[model samples]
Target: MRFTEHEMTVAVDTVARRLHAATRPPWRRGDAVAAYDGLERMKKWRLKVTAGEVVLPVLTALPERPTVGAKPEFTEAELTAAAQTAGRDVMEHRKPGAWDAMPAKRRDRVLATAVELTRVAVDGMPVRQDPDALIVPDHL
Candidate 1:
């Protein structure tokens, strides 16, 4: 769940590329623009996460810094809110019928990964930066 700055950067880039590819050709111009804007917002969020100004509940510590500086502890309500926000964002972007199409086992694994990522992000724990360590399945 915890990811390095490099990992986050890769993720942002991958998402951007994927979104662009998805919105190409027959896709409406407005849809592409909206996707671009959303990606821009995500980039800003990634910057905040990198600067230690905002702690993302999906990432823990960076490789170089095993321990984080004095970040304010998030309350239970704050943690819940953050997790909920993450879930909603993911759900909003998911392809229609995709969730229902997944096998139950796969769905459970995905949910577990989400929980782990959220926990590490909230705890500010250190994590590796392997680009290939993405949780997304190839079939998806």
Candidate 2:
């Protein structure tokens, strides 16, 4: 799908936020790196397909930007620790930048694209009505 620069930028942020929220303790060494790689690929795809270059946004404008503040309430380590405490499966956190697999910023975009894509069926049907086809494969 075709995505504009602003869309990509906002998307990356969303993924990063969710990733941060989903962090787990004792993360792997290169998770961040892996996530970033995923984001880059997403950006390329958006640029290439021009999915709905002039349509999606008109359908739904993103919500108001969050308020800026001082330093974040939780660092990566803190979030990881929290995840562990909450019994969340931090190992499966799949945003681009949450770990070394990706930079925090780009991860958001990647996630947005992923979620956006998975919402659709392969046959061009809305996924909410037919989600079986959007299933993702497990990683090694």
Candidate 3:
């Protein structure tokens, strides 16, 4: 979720300072506090799309099911983990709504670019290759 100018400023002012104080090894108390605070205020965030033509709801309600799918190939645990890592990426094609508008192409372009960027960013993260590791989430 994206924050407005006012919201961004307020978050930086209120939570950023608390985060600095909790800096410690193994556990960042301040960071945890800031995360908790952000969760408390998650509702205030809005969905950000540059096109702004399509009106999508800014806030999301709690999902009905913790895991969406437990059928076919993916299990409940896999679905839960996937959902936790990547929240609803549901996007509608604006072309269906647009009536021969020039901006339709632009909207599709923006959506495509956003998806590509997300893919690149996710791939760019460093993968842990601990040879001694036996479990997927041993630390957890």
Q: All candidates: CA RMSD in angstroms?
A: 15.7, 18.9, 15.3
What is the C-alpha lDDT profile of model 1 across 1-140, one tens digit per residue?
Answer: 34456545544443444435454677455565465456667764554444332234333322223333332344455454554445444554676556566677876665554444444443443234344555788899
Error of 2 at 85 (Å): 36
Model 2 lDDT, full chain set? 0.36
- Measured against the true structure, the TM-scores of the candidates, in listed sequence, are 0.30, 0.21, 0.22
After superposing candidate 3, which stretches have Cα over 4 Å from the reference? 1-89, 92-103, 128-140
Whole-model lDDT values for every prediction: 0.46, 0.36, 0.33
The model with the greater lDDT, 2 or 3, is 2
* Model 2, span 1-140: residue lDDT tens: 33335544444443443343345345545475355445566654553344343223311332232223221122334333332322212223445333446565665554444334322211132112222345567982
Order of quality (TM-score)? 1, 3, 2
lDDT minimum window of 10 residues, candidate 3: 53-62
Report the lDDT tens digits of candidate 3 across residue range 1-140.
Answer: 33234433433333333323333255644465455445433322321222111112211111222222221122334433333223223332434434334375665554444333333222232332333455577677
The TM-score measured for candidate 1 stands at 0.30
Candidate number of the best TM-score = 1
